[model samples]
Structures are given as structure tokens and as C-alpha cells.
Target: MSPLPTDAPILPLSQTVSAQRPGDAPALVAALERCRAEDGAFAYSAGREIGTFRIEARTLNELAQRLAGVTAVAAVALETGPIAIQPCWTPGRLAEAEHRLGSADGGTGDFAVVRLRIVPRRSGEGNIFETEFAGPPEIDALNAAVARGVARASAEGVEGEGRIIDTRVVFIDGAFHPKRSTPAGFEEAAIAAMRAACRTAGLRRLEPLMEIEIMAERDHVLPVVNDLATRGGSELRRRLAQKGVAIAAELPLRAFLTYEGDLAALTQARAKIIGEPQLARWAEVRRR
Candidate 1:
């Protein structure tokens, strides 16, 4: 199983199912039919006779629990999706973060002047890595070294809370002795400078928002709406349905994690809720 994209909208719960043996297709299909009968909300499409089957569910946990009893199934895997990370930065917050790393021979050291900033990119704009340093030393090696440094810092993170996501690391200025400059020295310097810059610039955490719809009886709708409000839901709209009322709203994913159980308890197991991740927005830092 994998986490879905934080910004994805209306992502249905999907899983891939495979049989244990080549001849188990018939058994697998029968077992899957049983699962589908038990929960009419999900549907599956046939694959190659011996290939995997794809299933989508409104409630994955319930479906998975039922699938666990299907002896013909060998494995079930959830479809993966994109992850989101937004780090806020400003020029005022960024300083020329500098670092010096001495050569192995103890010669004059390499000094790296790096400017790291979180220039927020439009969705899908990607990241930028630029170098303006001119050198007798190979520029490609220096660039590679700088890249390694940035990658290491990104993976390690500024304070270990979360890895640095999308950000720009520029080698705007630096000094490298022709004789003492080495890729290793420049790499170390870049890493140190990147971390220093991140610490100085600070970080802002953003959490994903989800669009959700809840179905509850007329008498239970008000209580459900109130509960959603307490969980930071917004833009609530309601409409009459044949069986009940449907309420639609946007809510932070964190607050919505336990909503299913809470909805059951609140409506005496008579309410149904489903959601899809929408966009992300700046939020107060909280542990996941």
C-alpha cells in the first residue's frame, strides 16, 4: 500500500489483485465475485486471463477486510499517487549562506557561497538549480558536486521534521583555489551552505485539503454538519436526496482521517462519507 497524492481530487480507492497460481484465474474470479456481492459499491474489470485484476472501492478498508478471506488471492496492492510538499521562502529571509571546506592536503580551502530559496513555483513548474561560478576546475564536476550536496540536504532535511521539498539552490558566488579546489570540498561546502540557508529562511508546512460528501438522514444532517465544522470543514452545501441529505465540503485531510468512525458513531452507523484530496494550503505545523 502507498499514500495517495495530497493534492489529488476525487481519487477512488483502487487496488490490483493477482492470483496465486497460473490456473487460479477461475478461483480468483469466483472469490472476487463473492467480494463484490458483499459490497456492491466497488467494481472490478477483467484483465488478461492470468493477469492482475483491478478493483475500485468506496471504502477500501472494508473491501480489504473481505478480500482477506479470499483464499485464491495471492496479493493486493493499492495504487500509488503523487506526493505534495510546499516550502515557503522569501528574499528577505534568505542570506548568502557560506561554507568553507579544506582540501585533503590541508591547502587553501574551497569557499562556497550559496543562495538557497524557496521560490514558489506554479503547480508543475518544477525546480531550478543554477551555477554562475567560473573555474579552471571542470564546471561539470563542480555542478555535479553542488547537485549531490543539494540532494543530500534535501533528503536529510533542515531539522529532521520533513525533507526539504521543492526549492532552488544556486551557486551564485564562490571561491576555489586552482590547486586546492576539489569536488569533495565543494560538495561539503554546498551541503553546509544549503542547510544554513534553510535554517535562516525558515519553513512553512502545507497540508492537503479534501473535498468530501456525506449522506445522512434529514434528522441526522445537522449533527453531521456540526461535527464537520468542528473538524475544520468549510464551504458546506446541502441538497435533498432520495434517501437522505447530501452535504459537500472541503476539509483538511488530517482532520478527516478519523471521520468515518466518528460519522458512524454520530449517525448510529447510518451516515456514509467519501472524499477525494484536493489542493494543499499553508497550515500550522503539526506532527503527522
Candidate 2:
């Protein structure tokens, strides 16, 4: 055997897919170990409670196949959830330079005045809800209203593009009328304020980026490369391998979703490709 070329493509694990099954810790660990031994590039952590298996793989398809194998052996079921692309506007960034303050008033006599703004937060920091409204029952109501506003804004999305994520909704300041403002009034004000803020923030939709690698016969390399180019691939790198040519690129998850079938047709089922999520980047909003 010969050592592989230094520049040969190495598929790095970029995404983690988790599946839960009813099993004991030992059984889950045993199943994962078998998979790890078979799949050279594999990593996972299994827990007893529901047997959560966090499997890291180079592509979503590969992840699914690996999970299927484990589930078959462990008698576990796979649970799937919705995958979403979120829109966001990071405050103080040049992209959001057009962001303007948004405010609104609601309730009889305009008794509840709410001012709010949306700003980006560090990934995994979750959401932070803040308010400068004053004390007790009204303040509590204001807090709940702020939460409702954020949820509504997230659900409605920016111009119906998608849900909002990785942002903070701050109730910068607001007024409450002791007699005229009701809890329902404050809730109405918050919801309206959130809508206003999202409209002015100039939010951009975000999509996950994937780091991908493809290996193809030298004769088919050109066609594969062209196909990737049309799919919006970037940061491309190619090198000669012992068996064929290896190519690597960064592509958006959306663009790569249907690539398996396309690649098969293009290369006559002679090419192999794998990809995993790398990071998220601002994406152009889809026009209806």
C-alpha cells in the first residue's frame, strides 16, 4: 500500500444528527462502537435516557444511512423534526445600516406605548428579553407581552421569508397608563412594535453552508465541477488522487439537497460526493 497524497481530499465532519431510541446505555454504546469501527470517520455520544445518539458525519445522507444501521441493530426508532432557515439582522453591522427605530402605541386613548428593537446575539446564547418598563402587575404584563411579540415576529417571519432566530428583542422603553392601559392593550402594543422593528431592520435570510468533497474519474471531473458551479458552489479546490480527482467546495444546504441524483446522472453513477453543514451565511430572499 502507498501513502495517500498530502493534498488528497479529507472529508471533515461538519454536521451532527441526533436520534433517540428506547434502549439501555450499554446497548446504545455497543451499537455506536460497531458503527465507528466500520466507518473510519465517525464520532458519537450516546446517552441512556431515550438513548440519544449524536452522530457526526460528512453529509446528511451519510448521517441518515449510519443512523439507519444503528437503529436496525439496536431496535431504535428515528425521530425527525422540521428544518428551518431563519432570517436575521445583526445590529451595528454594515448590512443593517438602514435599520431604523420602530415603535407603536395601542389600547384605548393610546395608553400603552411600546418601543422595541431587534439585534443579533451570539450563536447558542438563546434569546434575551429585556424591558425598561416599571414595576409589579403592569411590568409583569409588559414582560409577557414582549415575549408574545417576539414569538409572533419569529413565526410571521420577515416579509414571509422565514422565521427569525439568533436575535434579541429589547423593550427599550414604553409608557403605561394606570387606568387606561390593560394587559391586553400592552400585548397588542408589543406585537405591533415587533412587526414595526422587523420591517425597518432590513433583515436578510440565512441558509446553512456545507463543506463538500467529491471524487470522480479524471474523465468525469470536468462535468462534475461544472455541475457544482451551477449549484452555487464556492471556495473550490481540486487535486489529483490515486484513484481519481478529488474536489472540495462550499455549497449552501438548499442547493445541495438534490445533488445526489444530479451527480449520479452526470457521472453515470461513477462519482462519489459527501457534504456536511459548515456554517450559516446571509442568503438572498426567494422571490415568490
Global lDDT scores for all candidate models:
0.58, 0.58
* lDDT for each residue of candidate 1 in 80-188, tens digit (9 for 90 to 100): 2222132322222444577766544454555444444434333333345667776664766876787777666665443432345445566777766656666787778
Clashes of 2: 0
Number of residue pairs clashing in candidate 1, backbone atoms closer than 3 angstroms, sequence gap of 3 or more or interchain: 0
* lDDT at 268, model 2: 89
Model 2's TM-score against the true structure: 0.51
107-147 in candidate 2: lDDT tens per residue? 34535777776676564344456666667665786567656
* Candidate 1 TM-score, C-alpha based: 0.54
Candidate 1 residue 63 Cα shift, in angstroms, is 16
Once fitted onto the true fold, the runs of candidate 2 whose alpha carbons sit more than 4 angstroms away are 1-110, 121-127, 159-161, 208-213, 217-229, 235-249, 265-268, 275-288
How well does candidate 1 score on lDDT at residue 68?
A: 65
Angstrom error of the Cα, residue 138, model 2: value is 3.4
